[model samples]
Target: MSLTIAVTGMNARADNPGPGLAVARCLKESALAPRVIGFGYEALDPALYHRGFVDRGYLLPYPSHGEDALLARLTELHEREHFDVLIPCLDAEMQSFARLAPTLTGMGIRTFIPNSHQLALRSKDRLPELAAATGISSPRTQAVYQANFFHTCEAQGWRYPLMVKGLFYDAKLAYNADEAVAIFHRIAGEWGVPILAQSWILGEEINLAGVGDGLGGLAGAVMMKKRALTDKGKGWAGISIHDDELLFAAKRFCEVTKWRGGLELEMLRDEQGNLHLIEINPRFPAWIYLSAGVGCNLPDLLVRLALGEQLLPTPPTPAGVLFIRYAEEAIVSLADFENITVLGETLRFGALA
Candidate 1:
């Protein structure tokens, strides 16, 4: 019970905290009983982290305040209660965690992340270019920071039906130059930065999740196609997709990044049968828990890696296993309806104990 296991960036209301909870639960179930420390704007379900995996819980206003500040408290806590590992599931925390890894090592915390330059390449409008150079295909795109470059993209044959994507948030689709300029101003006013423009290809959305060894080796891989996505368009609500093409692109992307941690690859297929890289999430996405149920156990495997163990090749994680978002509907005021849509499965794991 002396070892501490921290799963940061969790909220009590979070429907799927995925890696944070999955790894915490695995460590606890395995009798590690490491203290689980969670940080976020809101409190987490104490029953999950504090009462179970966590022995002590503290809340922070936000992670931006300080990274090591929490660690300092952990150091204080370690004087009274020791910790063995720190697992970060938040996007904001990954780069900072990686930057501080050396210091954390000296302070007795085990963690992982890509270097800053690489991390920057993974973020914002620069991602697609990096992907293309590494033999991965990205959408027909242009990132415009200067006002004059908008016309440059048009001159290069990027025309109507293009997307003006917010660097930190949403993407506004404009079918013409006028609309594109208006959307650009709106986005620039709010975000105060350049926006990424790309041809809007309406096709199936796919995500490839996996882990890599810092070197060119892979630990595990799982593929998911969107069955449903939230209307506003950040992630999928339900997904239905799987293919070797997906896996190869994911493997190649991870290999190219030299990424060492959980990664979620966002991609799209055009009408010509080309796979285009969209985005790369270096942490667990919301649906990652579904992978565990299907037999991947990425979170558990990731924890073992943090403990400095050499990773084994990932076993077949249900190649055909599928996911559906369970939703409640009201047929009428008198009765409610629940829907469960089963998709497919390569192999299924036993229910969590």
Candidate 2:
């Protein structure tokens, strides 16, 4: 029998898309060809209406609603969907999902995600410590609880053009104290504090996406460098690459944390050619489809891992594989919209393929 899989992070805004739709596309194209259920917080999340990608769609309560609300909703959905596996692709929702992993397993929903402690170890505030533990270099970073810190940060040896970041998402380059304060308030208002400030390094950004086997080994890895970026600094186009240092850093990360499930490593390669670990995202990124394109197919591996199947060592991804993201309209019937807006679920009548 084909497995039913549920995935979250379905928002696909052009400026900052979520990873759910890309993950769904990967799963649909995989050999298992499982049924894909797309979960989003808003009715208008474009992925919800994409008939080609999501076999079914539903709306979920915002992560801010707390875990009890999440658990209750998942229980209700489980009775109807009978999801065999779940992949949560948003950073904000990861904590709730991680804490609820055992409960989800009890309900016959398998999730391959880091536990609460593992998640905490790679948090933005703790990146410096994690970098040091892995013998990798990271930018000098500090947590900011108030905006006033930006005004006097120069005294603490922080310079201009520093990076201002939220705990879970959003990063802005603050060129001066005023800009830093404004960014601090903006991110704090949206994602809440403590906001992060890091010494800026002039360099090109490189990223790695991989799955850890939960036993200090990496199951698969793919790396990329942004060729173009959205106004929000999200990668709009990228090319896959193979870098030994970057791969070594990822291996060290998995060895130290024994992280399970999907992870993205953001790194800055400085003019001196040294790699600085920037941020560790707890879930797959919006560009995860590139993994499938490069022949690794990490989401598929994650499903196999969740199902307790052994994974073979992934083949090396060929360099220069490119992914260019584009936005297109999904024509949706009013009935489908009403089903999600009014009843919170829409089941497409079709084969799994």
Best by lDDT: 2
Best by the TM-score measure: 2
The estimated TM-scores of all candidates read 0.76, 0.98
Candidate 2 residue lDDT tens string, 42-159: 9889898777888888898998889999999999999988999999999999999999999999989999999999999999999899988999999999999999999998998999
lDDT of model 2, residue 251: 93
Tens digit of lDDT per residue, candidate 1, span 1-353?
35567676544233333345544554565534455654444432322233444444444335567876755655664454355677677665677677777877787877755667667767757766777667877776667876555656667887678888776556777877777878888888877667788778877777877776677656777787766555556444544355788788766766777778778888888777788787777777657666666677666666677788876687666545666544322121111101111111000111121
For each candidate, what is the lDDT?
A: 0.62, 0.93
| Candidate 2 segments whose C-alpha is farther than 4 A from its true place | 350-353
Candidate 2 backbone collisions, by pair: none
Model 2 deviation from the true structure expressed as Cα RMSD, one decimal place = 1.8
